[model samples]
Target: MRTIVAQDVVSASKFNRFHLLVFLWCFYAIGFDGFDIAMYGVGLPWMMEEWNLSALQAGAVGSYSLFGMMVGALVLAPVADKFGRKNVIIICMFLFSAFTLAAGLSPNITMFTIMRFIAAIGMGGLMPNCISLMTEYSPKKQRALLVGAIYIGYALGGILASLIGMYLVPQTDWRVLYYIGAIPLLTIPFFIKQFPESLSYYLARQQVGKVVEILNKVKPDGNFSEKDDYQLHTALKDGKGFPVKKLFTNKRAFTTIAFWIAIFCTMMMAYGLNTWLPKIMQSSGFSLTSSLSFNIMLCVGQIAGTLIGGYLAGKIGYRKVLVSLYLMGVVTFIALSITTNVALVYFLIFLGGASTVGAMNLGNPYITEFYPREIRATGMGYAQAIGRIGSILAPTLIAMLLVTGIDPKMAFATFAVPSILAVLGYLLVQEKYGSFDKVVEENGMNEEFIEGENKRIIQS
Candidate 1:
């Protein structure tokens, strides 16, 4: 079989029509994940009103979803390697679509909570695999940009959910929003027909015939030669077994753990504010209408931040950009907590949303770049799973303080501490490690390092 060389990825302009089509599917899957996740925030106010829930009860809903996501990311990420990325993604989409629709059909709080939990699993699994698939298929130089760009779907979804919720809140029931969520299911069949499994996975698994088929599909005019056979084996063998264990086995152990911790801290700040910001503002004397409108600004900032982060990371480097953004976020979170001036609060809120969302968008691709294709999904998954833990705790902890009549600024301040942890984590990882390229070369995955230096990360 002819080998798809690393150089082929470097010259992205040569990507044939088939690659572009597959690329579209990858974007679509992530887009669906983005929409489903953001839907929770949009429905929060209406659901609380309809059920007469306490602030703690409302927070529980967010917790349940994060809990579900944690479980999903842990379970599905590794299993996707064993089974296949495409199949797992298809199943994950179905799980969330069906359960989210069930959320609409719930008669009481118990059912809605249960359904959201189920949907969270699907939501959690969908993200890492979507990221992995995109990375695995992309040209080396474009990996970070494409990965970050695809996440725009996430911010877009957040905006879409807010818009839909705002528009429908006046006329239709909140339950109907869940019904609209199920629309993602319609794309499942189309994905199944068009999606390609990761070439790296197939090569590693020694499915030579399938690898050749996929490569031919990826590069229709290119010829496969026997010399490519050795490279395929090298790529496939690069990252097999307990990926998390492997990450820790080398000098990378501490750095890897630090990155995960950074992700956790970053997500805690993001989700804490996302799930509770409106509630906190309302309690601080803002009207529900104004609080709801704030989401539009937040999402707009998120989109801008995501685009800017992607571009900046491509130019400056991911970790530096992420660290700087997190610091900015911490400052904004502080400003948001203390300010009562409506206009200024809105501006700070938007800036805060931009930093947090952009940081996440930039960070995921950075994590994905740390591993070879064989274990890339798993690494991203563990980071996301651990990150979900932060998300799970943020709303719960903030709610507990608020219920006890603690100061609202103090409650927000509690959530802001994680950003400091994240900054420390990034700095520690960067200071401790060499470029990831040396590690990958030392680990002997040299042949499979298809992407160039621009996309390569240090071991951390």
Candidate 2:
């Protein structure tokens, strides 16, 4: 009888054609998500002009999308567990693309806000689900780099948003940007045909026929048949039960809380800057075109930061790299407030983008390391959902500060507040708690459980 070790498959991870496909689809999916979310920020100035919106109303429009993202991350992301990741991706794609297309037709801010909020609900699940699925497909040693690599999609998506805004908004209407969001709706059918299901999900269901098929693609050993038995590491098994309880199980309570707090703080910075930086730059005396152009630098910085941070994490560690990014944020934000040199201002915004969105992107893979496949999306979703509260608050709060005639320097400095808070929260994360080996060792989950044929899946 043939026996396959699931842990061994992941441990001796190798990249092949399968991994490349996963990477491309995930990158495209997330890039689409990025485009959808950032379009609001990119088009915000024109929308404000068209609607004659006050600072408060403009800020409220940004928050509407975030509010929907909160719901998707909090409520919809966990559905990936039951329905499967590929299915959820398709549903999310349709919701966002169709509604974003509908949004372009809205005649007023109220309707635009409603359509954006629903589209964002689709946007919310994309990150957690994509991050979770990618983590599953990546090799253990290369996990950080590959996971971090896919996140460049968010920056790429944002970059596309800015480019489209620059060319289209000035020539036509801001609503035209929303029309572009519907482009993804065409790819939903393609995803179903090409995207693979989670290997762990197949194993959990004891669908040995399907598991053998997918596993062979990832790690092809031609001698497999339905008669063979396979077992997963006890620690890796997606145990059945309430997933949230598992977040705190086996000495993880403190670390889970720390992740939520840090996510909350970091997201406030990431979404706040993405939504408002262009407007703030325009307010600081740059022309509208120039302000929009700066957003491309911001996204470029995110791509650069993730690659740099991923490399640094390999040298130092994920936790340390995250802290360094936050410290960088503290200084860059302050510098941005006082700088008048256009070149220097662009550089500062570059740093701001890296420290803000880059940190959030880096944090996802780190957070997923703690959970089994069954609940990876759930943990990520909840963390982002809690983080979404801060996001939901950011635009309005920044708008409130702007309307009060606060010094531009002080308004910029406020972003630094959450950066510091994120640093402190991550400082408190006990890395040992995230270690699967530690959990296995502490609970005394035995070799027999890891070796027996589908033992954990059956017992659970």
Candidate 3:
């Protein structure tokens, strides 16, 4: 009987067309999420003016969507582990695309905020699952670089939103952007037909046939077939039990909490800029055009930072890179707050984007690598869901500071505080807690694997 090791096959496989196809799936979906996020920021100044909204009211409107994103991250993303990643991704895309279009047609601020909240649920759910999917498929050697590459799609989406907003929001209306968001709905059916399911998800369910099918595609030369006998001693054991509780097992609790804190700060920085930077730039005495230009620069810097972070992470380590990024955020935000020169301001904003959203893009792959395959999606979800609290708060807090007649410089400086905390959070994480670490805390060395009664984390 032919035997297949699901974990071995995937990790040892070479990158090919199949891998690139998977990248496209994740990249395009995440790009749409980024585009929707930028829409709100681009539309915010106009939305407030159109509705005669106070600063507090506009902040509340922004929080509504973040609230939805938090709910979806906490609730929907984990469902992918059960129902399958591909299914959940398709559901999220449908809802996100449909509701975004609905938001544009909204007759009042009340209706618009409600629609945005619903659409954002999809965006929130989609982000973590895509990260999980991409991480699972990536060869361990190139994982960080591939994850970083997909995020370029996210940055490009932001650039697309900014460019469209620069022209359309001023010429016709912000609604035009939302109309374009619905375009994803048309492509969902095609993805459903072509997208592949998670190999481990099938293995966990004891569906060897599906596992064989996926392995065949991932490495077509392997000649995998349903007829092959499989020995998934790891999957059968690890797959049992609730994925969430298992996160605390093997003395992983502290590292889990540290990741949560770090991600929370990352989101706080990322969403703060995505939602409020343009307005912050305007309030700092820049023109409307230049303010929007600053946001574009922020996205451009993200692409640069993500690629650099990925490369540096491979050479040094992500933990060090992450801390450095946070420190960069601290310095750039402080400098940006005080700088008056156009060239200097742009440079600071670029670094701020790198340290903020760019750092966030890299953080996901880092977290996923630490987690075992069975709980990868759940692990990423909890971090982002908890982190969403910071994301949810940033818009309102920035708005409150703006309304309080505080110095715009001081308001910008507040972001520096979280970056400082994030530095500490990343530092506290124990490297031994990582899934791939051979010397784990559980045994002070890798625990011996004994299937059935004695199995632990399945080696991914």
lDDT of 2 by residue, 68-159 (tens): 99999877767886667777878888889999998999989888889888999998887888898888888665777888989898899899
Candidate 1 TM-score, C-alpha based: 0.89
Each model's TM-score? 0.89, 0.92, 0.93
* Cα lDDT of model 1 by residue, 240-355, tens digit: 56766766654667777887898898788778877777677667777776666787688777777778888887777888888888888888877776777889877877787777
Best by TM-score: 3
Off by over 4 Å in 3: 1-3, 437-460
For all candidates, the clash counts are 7, 0, 0
List the global CA lDDT of all models.
0.74, 0.81, 0.84
Candidate 2 — which residues are off by over 4 angstroms?
Answer: 232-237, 436-460
Which of 2 and 3 is the better model by lDDT? 3
In lDDT terms, how accurate is model 2?
0.81
Residue 50 lDDT in candidate 1: 83
